[model samples]
Target: MLALSAWAAASSRAWAQAPMEPHERDLYEAARREGQVTWYSAQYSADTSEAIGRAFTERYPGVRCSVVRSTSQVAFQRLSQDQRAGVAQCDVFASSNGGHYIQLKRQNRLTQFRPVNADGMLPMLRTADPDNYFQYSSLGIYLLGHNTNMVSDAEAPKSWADVLDPKWKDKLAVGHPGFSGAIGIWALQMRSMFGPDFLRRFERNKPQVGRSSIDPVTMMTAGERAVGVAVPSASTLFAASRGNPLKLIYPTEGVVAVPAPSAIMSNAPNPNAAKLFMEFNTGPALSRITRTMFSESLRPDVPPPEGCRPLDQVTLLSPSLEDADRGVPELREQWRDIFGV
Candidate 1:
């Protein structure tokens, strides 16, 4: 778990609740009767997810938010199992992989409800699904990160290709694409930039592979690994803030900007609560909570996280909906074949 900092805890407590409009008030009332919202989330750390859930409960007063946090693939698998068993346990689904939304929307498994707060988000991140089945709830960059104590700035890997150098052999950490959606996308992007054999070359470095993308940062902070191949910028920066010897490196090629999205499930048992939770996700409270945790803020009113550049100022690389839908699955299999994990 990522430890919540004193600043983050204080920020969460200090956030003022915004008065709901008539439509939101009606939804909140209906959601109160349902009592709680269950969220299967893969976008943030468990602590951060729980913090957001607590913030939602505090803001609305009656409805509770139950958070089930996991890596993207694990969360999707659990949701798929629930559906297969004819269970409607998840009220809302948030995943780091955009491809999951595409697949679910095709099967008519997602509820199409546009949040009133969608207009408050950054204009570029607003549209994950044109039909409004899913909205970008979180944004993060995937880039290189190193343990500052082990590797000085001058000696650290400067670009994506730098990690492949033999000098870093057995000193690298990475996330498994088979488990992490963001890592799947990052692997796909690496393939696009380098070639099909990129992972094979990367495998030669003997990286310590972990299930979630955040794991790479964890390894670096522990000094178990000197460098992270592709790690989430938010967690890396957060670790640095906590006095961890971590530093992020935006690759010369481009940073992979991932827009983690959320949507209501069509068969949600607490349908009204799900809609209310979706609205809460795009609202100011969640934005404030995420910003304090050093993650991207979806709302325009919330500034970018401390220690990070504004999203617009960074050169970001993203997969198209079609590319991500097709590519991520393939990358997972390829990753398993190459890494044997």
Candidate 2:
């Protein structure tokens, strides 16, 4: 009886609220009344991300947004575990793991609401889900990092192949494929290009895998690993700003990009707040946040971030999700067998 009554009330309001921009105007007013939303995010730093959060709360004064940060892989694991245990504490998820989000979309655990700001995205960043279940970030959202004293300017691995060189034997730091979607695609791309020998060839370099996805950067930053696979754009830019001698290797084979999407949970306690938050994040604020973080904005026509090369100029890897999904189980087996993890 209660559920039916609630549905009737919501439908009646939705009807009365139907304007050309009903998605936003209705969401905004409804959100102010609900007042709170929870987000599970995986970000390398709290400051910049939190700045986004703080700015959001300020922007939507009555709508409170709380973010729980975690590593992307770990965050996904938590979400999965929580869901199975019937402890759905998270209201939304914002992360750079497209493959995982794709799996979630398959399960229909997500709400489908097209963002009012979808028109702002670049052609490449757009998702099939016109609703905001997922959205891709700009090119090389993660970057290559190397120890200054070890890899020289001209000697560094300009392309992904350079990392396979035996010179860096056991000296290279690679991200754990499961934890790092950036590396997961890199791994898939490696196999996609090189066949079964790729991991064995990579092994000759004796790449050390990080615990979390960002471990490679941590290793490179400490000079523990001479050459590393990926670093958050924030860390790369901050290091570059200080003239850290670290280089951003815009892949000669083209930078790979994946969706760092935000999704609203189906059973969200604060659906109104969640909707408002998503709209706020996906709009002008996302453009500003991404631009500030040195990421290519999803808004396609927007220019590349400062100190970044244009995506068109570099070689890119177009991953087939269908292929990626098929390969994941086998890929994980291959990684374990080869890496002996």
Best by lDDT: 1
- Per-residue lDDT for 168 in model 2? 75
Q: Global CA lDDT of candidate 2, please? A: 0.66
Candidate 1, residue 259: lDDT: 86
What is each predicted model's overall lDDT from 0 to 1? Answer: 0.88, 0.66
Across 205-274, the per-residue lDDT of candidate 2 in tens digits comes to 7888875556776677777877777555555665555555666676566656554567887777788887
Q: Model 1: per-residue lDDT, tens digit, 1-341?
A: 24445666665666534567898899999999999999998999987899888888887788999999999999999999998899889999999999999999999999998998888888887777889999888887899999988999999988899988999999999998888999999888889989999999999999999999999999999999999977988889888988898998988888998888999999999999999888888877787788777888887787878888787778898887678999999889888898899
**What's the CA error at residue 196 for candidate 2, in Å?**
2.0
Which residue pairs in candidate 2 have backbone atoms (N, alpha carbon, C) closer than 3 angstroms, thus clashing? 121-300, 122-298, 122-300, 136-259, 170-205, 253-315, 254-315, 254-316
Q: Which ten residues in a row have the lowest lDDT in candidate 1?
A: 1-10
| Model 1 CA lDDT for position 37 | 94
Worst 10 residues of 2 by lDDT: 11-20
